[model samples]
Target: MKNISKFIKIIKTLNFIPVLSVFAISSSCSNKINYNSSTDYENNQNFSDIDERDQVLNIIKKADFVKFDSEDINKIYDNFNYYTKGNASPYIKIKKSLQLFEKYWKIDKNSEPWVINILNKYDGPDITIDAINDEIIINKYDKNKTQEVNNYVEMFGDSIIINKKVCNFGYDKKIKTSEYGFKIISYENDILIPYYIFNTLFLSPNYINLYYDGTKYQLFEKIVNFDNKKFKNFFDCAFPGITPFKEIREDSYNSLKFLMNNYYGLNKYYEYTSWESILDKYRDAMLDINPDNYTGAYFNFFNSLNDLHSNIIIPSLFNYRIKYYQQSNKRKTYAKLDNQLKNRRSLILENSDQNTNFFGYLRNNLFISFDEFTQNMNVKGKDFELKNLFLSSILKLKNHKDVNNIIIDLSTNGGGDLSIMLWIAKLLSKDKEISFYNYNDLNESLIKSTLSESKFSTQYLSKDFIQAKNILKSKQVILLVSNNTFSAANLLTSIVKDYDLGLIIGAKTGGGMASIMPTVLADGTSVAISSNNLFLNKNRTQIEDGIEPDIKLPYDDFYDFRKMEQAINNFQKTK
Candidate 1:
């Protein structure tokens, strides 16, 4: 009977779920490619006049010679580690072995078809010999195969070489951020074979004869080679020394900016049809790269990665002004609306108008400084602290009068503590039981517990919910929101819409709506990933697209509030 009653209670709670919302957008830390027109390639005879050879020659001539230094090798290795995977336990052994090999390998000029060591197995496409032409020919496209080839005829006659070698770690061992460094492979067979293996891998490619001669070699564009031994060098040249993760991330952004400015012109890539308008001024730098080909190249690059957070930012110089203005406007608007918010504070209790002898109306400042309030408390799990503080203040003002109409000024709240949003809402609601569908990843092992595990389901917990639901039933709230209301704040706004709890009046909330996974590597370096999908309400509408507010109110419009206040005062007098 007890169990039955408990289940009934649970069912009831699920039915009356007070609009679950969160403005807090979580992000997975993204620690972060390609090529060209084929029609221009098939017509090689026309290309000779196109200075193709000379172009290659000039690139080689101007190409920066990157020496193999210990630091450079380490940087390359570091980068490789982030992308590749190795045995869970044997990574240390593998890295050590590769480092030793890289230290001994003698690097010099004229190492024909430069060979990168087979730190692991090369498993991409391989070449196939042709029968009719008495010459090698590689199949351009082959599905479910591990080999790629490029066959071309040079002045000397037929030439066959391998174009790409896709390598993988130990069988099904996923690549991680650390154990990705590689060792050099042999430069035999007219291909740079990094010691890796794929199916039917002994073969090479039959590609068109396109050579980068010594004169043109200097002008050839350079590419980064990653291995345990080359990571430090890559870091020093590309970014530089052990620095904060934020700084390293900025370097990646800058690198992308340079690529956009020099390689692909913006105007050609993202005109009215593309993201160029969104890019605004940065479009000019993008146009300078290759006005005609920039759009195609940028799109190709943007789609190269599957990670959601992987992206390209033009440059800080271009984005800085826009960001400054946005922030400045927000601050000014928040200040103007401060008094209106102050005037609407009310008591949280039921029918306590007579208690006015003890307490007056509450203050309107809805924003609380996290750093100041969390001084002594262990904030890690103190999700109820802020809302409880707000409720306690409201209760003190309950003077035996039923104060149902209220205003929550969320303009300055940057959003924190999801439970707090729910709790505060509960103070105004009358529902004894509020319910929401409990959704979660059953694979607990997939969840990284070091940062947050049980916390993800805090909203669904029974004990943590009742107070907030009760608050929502009786109070008709007008939440003053703005762009500053983010993450949990946004979630709160979403709840209002979904549950029909209240109305949101303000600018659009922040757009970050992804859930993140915080991880700490062996080196103590921490990073986050967006592993789980999140939703807004019980119906499970994914939150990444964000929740739309019921009413749109511009933060800059303060005069509009004076009229609203006057109307409310008149209604109060009539009552």
Candidate 2:
């Protein structure tokens, strides 16, 4: 009875489309059209007839029905049977399963459960395949045969071909079966269409994907292995627009469906009372039938996936990190200049035995508080521009003379814009020119940064963007730093210590250093590309080890101001 009804169902589906009769074409259109010269005849042919045929061909072409040759199709079938014929080992069985999966899925990056389910059957005790309700779980096998997976070449007479390489799998020993019985990768996801995926891929589905993942409707691949010619003819009839007699197989249908579903795997899930109820009540959506709230409902359903890697979204949300950064820059103009200037200054007193000034300020002379540095570029936020504020403060302090021998503390400072650091260095020197290391040309690379008497980094180094080479040659400087001082902060410290520009006294600095441009992905996610590698001073020391201070102060002594004061007093007396 079931077999009888299957034929009836196919007939019913065929009712809407007209099946082309070869006899009818031969009788009516043979005189006017030369089948052999069909391409040329298209121009001379009746435009209306040509358009009709084109539309029919378009529909047929899209339908998954036919393929190029019988031999290619048979090869897949033969391969499956060959592996299944013997009581093959788990590895061999897995290979056969993967062969079928590849044939079905073709080429895609991520894992699709439909294809993965087939592979589960071939796994040893280490893998368990379960379909409870409408959910499919593929987990590690329980068997503890912890032997590494051997190379296919080592195990078999022939090597496994991957990316045109024979037995390249041995390069990474980790991928080879470790002390485990077999190499396995497990994944978990709610079933989309329990009936369809399970039946087509797993060969069984106990329940429909109704209440499983809150999905109201699910799409499934329906694969039919038939005689190549018969399948092609059926495909031509069902979808007349698609060209007939093309290569079509179960694998082709599986591959196309896999791509579409994976590419458009809607994050949305449907809520239902039960799996049985969904199959009985809501299967029509799979057929692409129209509903009342068409567009809105469709989009709402589509957006449910929420996965940026797999799901689609509106234009606004696409490439989100980049857009946010751009938007932030646009709003930078609205930020008041004075507020930015106020934030750059770090007010701290330098207590020296011979110092005349109190509340001695060593401003963020670099980039003169981020304002003068990031001046024209549109960027927003106090946190994002925290370095700018520090620079602004340093600039303010450079001109104030109530301050004497400066103490520029990079102790806990993580690092920021290199331009800002250079500015600060220039201000400390008091000379119009200050020479510092250039990352690009370290062999004998020299940069002269400049500062105005009143402002931090007021001048630029024209030679290598030099502005203040003279002032740095004259000032008495004390540089304080610690392990937390890293990146941009470390870069500045490296210059101060190497050139003897300042007396650096503290613990080793945090060495994290990388110069990279930030790139925002289409989904508004930001990523940094660390392409250029920057090195330390001419000593050839790498930044990864961080900059060690010339004088290593006791950790407690540095933190205790009273201890530091006593130490400074003792030094002054000795002088």
Give a tens-digit lDDT track for model 1, residues 465-570.
Answer: 3344444455557666665555455555666666666666666764333232222111111122222212234343434344555556554452245543544455
**Candidate 2 structure, TM-score to reference:** 0.30
Candidate 2, residues 1-575, lDDT tens digits: the string is 00000000000000100111111101121122233543311223232432231121111111011122334431212211110111111111222233334433222224344333332322111112322222223222213322223111110111211011111111100111111111222222321221122222231111111000011111112111122344322222221122211111121222223222211111011122122232223223322212222222223332332211121111111111121112122123222322221222222222222111112232322211112222122223113343334334444444754433445555645454444554454434433233322222101111122122323222222322122234334444666666656556676677677656776766787554434322111111112222112333434344545687866766555434455445554665776
What TM-score goes with each of the models?
A: 0.35, 0.30
The models' CA-based lDDT, in order, is 0.28, 0.29
Flag regions of model 1 displaced more than 4 Å.
1-388, 400-402, 425-429, 432-472, 517-532, 558-561, 565-575
Over 4 Å off, model 2: 1-403, 429-475, 520-525, 554-559, 568-575
